[model samples]
Target: MEKVIILTGASRGIGRAAALMLAKENIVVMASRDINALIELKKEIGASGGKSEALPCDVAKENEVKKMIEDTIQKFGRIDVLINNAGFGIFKRADKFSLEEVENLFRVNLFGVFLCVKYTAPYMIEKKNGQIINISSVAGLNGFKGGSAYSATKFALNGYSESLREDLKEFGIAVSLVCPGGVNTGFGGAVADGKISRDFLLEPEDVARTIKYLVDESETANAKMIELKPRRRKEFR
Candidate 1:
């Protein structure tokens, strides 16, 4: 059976790559705040003979998250996979971060994941089988100079995903976390201006492939968490 997958932040970066790859075999329901980009992605997927549906969703908002889940369930009858890849980073000194900045980061990076899972888990429980992949970062595992606010959210996400895995294990739902080191994308206010050396960064498709692997794994086994990093490390300023 073709799996029905819900991928957040499908407009760009890792989410976009995952959507494109997953749509080749599964029915991908793509959600992002950028409706224009989502529409364009939908068209591209269609042109490639892939199945996809694009929906405008700001995962930070509960109502929007709820509606996205409801819409997917109504259309597909069941969600086989939920990929929470919607997140951003504000890299700056810890003291430089304003309260609003911290709050906004948490809203999307941490709270947003919570809202999505809260609304989607019951359905998976009812079905007794599903997969939830939360996209995290290496900063979540180890702190950095300018990653205070950003790392906090991912750290929280790490803890949340661990507990969620335990909670859903009994019901046959697999909760996995993918933590990738600096990827070659426009994440964290970084511009993809082609100046940065690609050797030091992991490609979005690399993470996408890992996601596909997790999705294709046998039901009786769960990989739990997978961390990806570039082999070469170079300083890019």
Candidate 2:
């Protein structure tokens, strides 16, 4: 079947990698806030003989999120997958989080996932099949200090993805949560920390390949949640 996917956070990082990898076989709707970067990525995909279109949209806003899904449907006729990869984080002590920080983190990480799924789910249902992949984190599995806000969002995402998986199980729409450890995306609102080593970090392509593998599963198989970690610890030395 010809696949069409709406992938958020495609301006860079994991989203960008997934878009490039999946577009080789699927029609990709690249949605992100960085217009220039997305346009460039779209061109790169085109040059590679892959199909993709760039949409500059912020997942944090409901109106924009809705419009993004609508635009994808209008263009592609059906959305076969929704990859909720858009996210950010600010590391700090739990007590140090400002109200704005909490709201902002939730706005993009939790609420964004909800809104994207809300708007895109029905079309998947109508087709009687689809995939929703939520990019979570190991921090969500085990909380740590200075990760209060960031961990909360991913934890909530895991919870929601779990329930949504069962809710739509009968409808042929699969929801999957992927919790990866220590990706080298310069994510979490900071560049790769100097104290951190790449030995324990996953590359963006590794996670991208995971997303593709999950999306490619047959109807008889469902990988509900997957966790990817580096083969060796960075601090082993």
Candidate 3:
């Protein structure tokens, strides 16, 4: 049987690319906030003879997340892999950004990951087999100017992923934290307040391949972290 995969933030960008690519090889249940985009994605994959389903979800909301997981379990029976890729970036200096906005950043990028992992882990543990891939950014591994809020959330994700990897390894669950540099996607459009480096950038498809690589690894090969950077040097944004 094909692996059962759950992915968040699947409406666009890296999440969307990952969902499409993975569906070619596995059964993918994609969650995202945009119902219309989800429909498009579902149709595209279904037309291609791939197995996929899209559900409307907002990872920042705990109740929504809970419902999504419950519904996923009801549909798929169990989750074999989870891709925590839902996130938002609010770029602004600490002085300019509101506390609410900063908190929103953390809610989606960090806390959202926590919520998804919390909901999905039990099923994986029960099966004694699974993989969790958290799509962190280079910002998680390194700091960037004007991105204090985004960086802070990603930094938290890095630490969370590290700790969880140790805790889950004993249960046959593999956790891989992906730290991608610049991926050409809606993320650039979302950066209304923060400026991203304009030099060479990684494509969302490339990052999706990284995610696929990690998820497809043999149960014996547990990759903890993988970082993707531009082939050319660019000043930090």
- Cα-lDDT of candidate 2: 0.88
Top candidate on lDDT is 1
Pairs of residues clashing in candidate 2? none
Candidate 2, run of 10 with poorest lDDT: 188-197
Clashes of 2: 0
Order the candidates by lDDT, highest first.
Answer: 1, 2, 3
The better candidate by lDDT, 1 or 3, is: 1
Off by over 4 Å in 2: 234-237
- lDDT value for candidate 1? 0.90
Candidates in order have lDDT scores of 0.90, 0.88, 0.87
In candidate 1 the C-alpha lDDT for residue 34 amounts to 96
Q: What is the lDDT of residue 80 in candidate 2?
A: 90
For candidate 1, the per-residue lDDT at 54 reads 94
Error of 1 at 129 (Å): 0.5
Q: What is the per-residue lDDT of model 2 for residues 150-174, given as tens digits with 9 covering 90 to 100?
A: 9899999999998999889898998
Query: How many clashing residue pairs, candidate 3?
Result: 0
